[model samples]
Target: MPELAEPIVIVSDVHLSARSNWASKLDRIRGLWQKAGTVVFNGDTLNLGLANRKEMCRQAIECIGQICQADGVRAVVLAGNADSILDGPRHLLLKGGRLLVLHGDVLFDSISPWRRSAKKLRAARDESLRKMPPRMRASIEGQQASVTEAIRIVHDRSGKRIRSRRRTFLENLVSLSWPRQILSILRAWRDAPGLAVNFMETYSPQANCLVMGHIHRSGIWHIGDRSVISTEGFEGPRKPGVAYVEGDSVTLRIARQTGASYQPGKVIGRVAL
Candidate 1:
């Protein structure tokens, strides 16, 4: 695969939609495009998982694409648990395969294990994997395929669950973050780094740095020889982290909102790939 442009900026879990503050976020991301040669939306750019929001998701994607075209910035959108319908690449290998970027949902068998539907999601994932040939199941592409299928299976039925309530987006978010769900989220955050390291060791042994965003925790951990980097989320409680990749190095920085745009803030971590 060819290399992305120099000074690539990667952000994930932006969750752009008509129901959220997507317009302002888009302005910030537009600023991001102006500062970098290429911008990668690591995953969950929009919540296509919600059947009711499919139209909104489509509009959000189109708007992003249009802006990218107008700005002349190369944009890459990877599929996430929420946006599994996207046909883009699920993972990227950078710096001669030493740096891996993915959405991070594939790190766990249950995907978003904190969700109320986690059991059903895991069952769907397991059934999909079981049907795959053993050789294919061992490959990264096959794993992504099964994950996409599982997401589809669960999310298709999720329409009924979501439509039963006519709550605002904030209310929906609050519902997902209830007390029990908070505990589950905390558990996932604690376990994610180790699972990420094991994932790279099993699938991409050449990669020493794994950059991902799903659990919405922006931090970096050094696990023996490997580094697990979570870029955080736009819709979460914490600020987001933007990963800048240039040459053989990757730097993690906090994103600070300045006026209508977001700029790279303090450097929290760095890794040599």
Candidate 2:
């Protein structure tokens, strides 16, 4: 693939669904696109896997396409756990292989350990890997395929839940923050950076910086020679973040609210290639 444009901005887990604030923030999102020569929605731009939300996802994608049509702007979408069915690449190597950008779900066997279907998804992933050719099993393609399979299983298991148009506070709280789920979330957070380093060591050893979003906790962690940067989810307890990629440097910034929309705010971390 060609080199990404300079001043590339990445945001993930926008989760543009029926209940999201996207409708009012469309202009703000467009403003973001206009600021950077290239804008990458790193993952979970929408829940395209749901049968009930297909039209909503389609509209969101169309809006994105329209924005990208403007002069000097480019948009790239990398598939996440929620939208793996979309035809988007799961990962990208940038800055001549010194920086890697992906949705980050492929780094775990369960894809999303905090989800209620964690064990089933983990088992599905293992089964998927076992079915692959032995040599390809360790490749990036293999990992991505397994993650996609796990997401497919999640869709199958949550079809009814997804189809429901309304959600109460208790329902949402239980699904997002039950005791078991909280423990799983903490474990995943603790393990993500190391997993990122191990993944680079296996496939792209030269890449010293990894940029991803999933698990929702955004921050930078330096482990040995590699730096793992996660751009937090759009809707979360902690503030969301965006990462800017420029010549030989990557900077992480919080998504600060400006009137009705969010834009890159304070710099949290910077990595030089």
Candidate 3:
């Protein structure tokens, strides 16, 4: 495969559904795409539970396809926890594996039991779908609907409660002293940064930086020589964020909604890998 070009844009947790005005949102970031050589949907771009998965994915692809075609940029889509049942790239490796870009769900595998269980369920669903006859499986709409319903059942069972608890735990931990917070992250639920560090040490020891989305909080943290970067969710009230990767440097940019369009805001954080 051809290598991705510089000034790559990594967007995560878009959570686009049938009701979302995602095309307009994409228009707001048109400049970024126009400048970018490659644009990556880091993950969770489609919220499978909220709409028919096939339709949602189709819309997302069409929207992104237009932007890439217009801007002469390459587009890559990665699957996140919400859409893990889908078939697509799950992560991207950059700069000879020095930078790892993923959805950040792997970090939560050990932090939340529900997430781990849900992954297993997703695997089972993928397997079942694989076993279906070619003709039956050819109708992506039916298969996606079934997968979405399965995900909804899993989310209803434990995912919602797990998220609430995780959020509360993170908030309380952040309120503590820096040292205490580190200790809490090590002892209890690993925050995004902690989890990133752990994931790197265990799976990709050579990776110096991890750019991920899923936590819905945009920030940068350093652990020794390694760094972890997170972007804000694209759907929520929190400022929508995106990460700009240029070689070994990464910068986080949030968008400010102005009437019907959005303009890039301040550089919230920067890190050098």
Residue-level error in angstroms, candidate 2, position 234: 2.2
Error of 1 at 26 (Å): 0.8
For candidate 2, write residues 29-113 as lDDT tens digits: 5555556888888988876544136676767777776767664678788889888877769888898889999998888888888
Worst 10-residue lDDT window for candidate 1 reads 48-57
Candidate 2 deviant stretches above 4 angstroms: 19-23, 48-56, 157-177
Choose the strongest candidate by lDDT.
1
Q: What is the C-alpha local distance difference test score of candidate 1? A: 0.83
Query: Clashing residue pairs in candidate 1, if any?
Result: none
- lDDT, model 2, position 44: 85
- The order by descending lDDT is 1, 2, 3
TM-score leader: 1
Q: Is candidate 2 or candidate 3 better by lDDT?
A: 2
Q: Which of candidates 1 and 2 reaches a greater TM-score?
A: 1
Q: With candidate 3 superimposed using the best TM-score fit, by how many Å does residue 147's alpha carbon deviate from the native? A: 14
TM-score of 2: 0.88
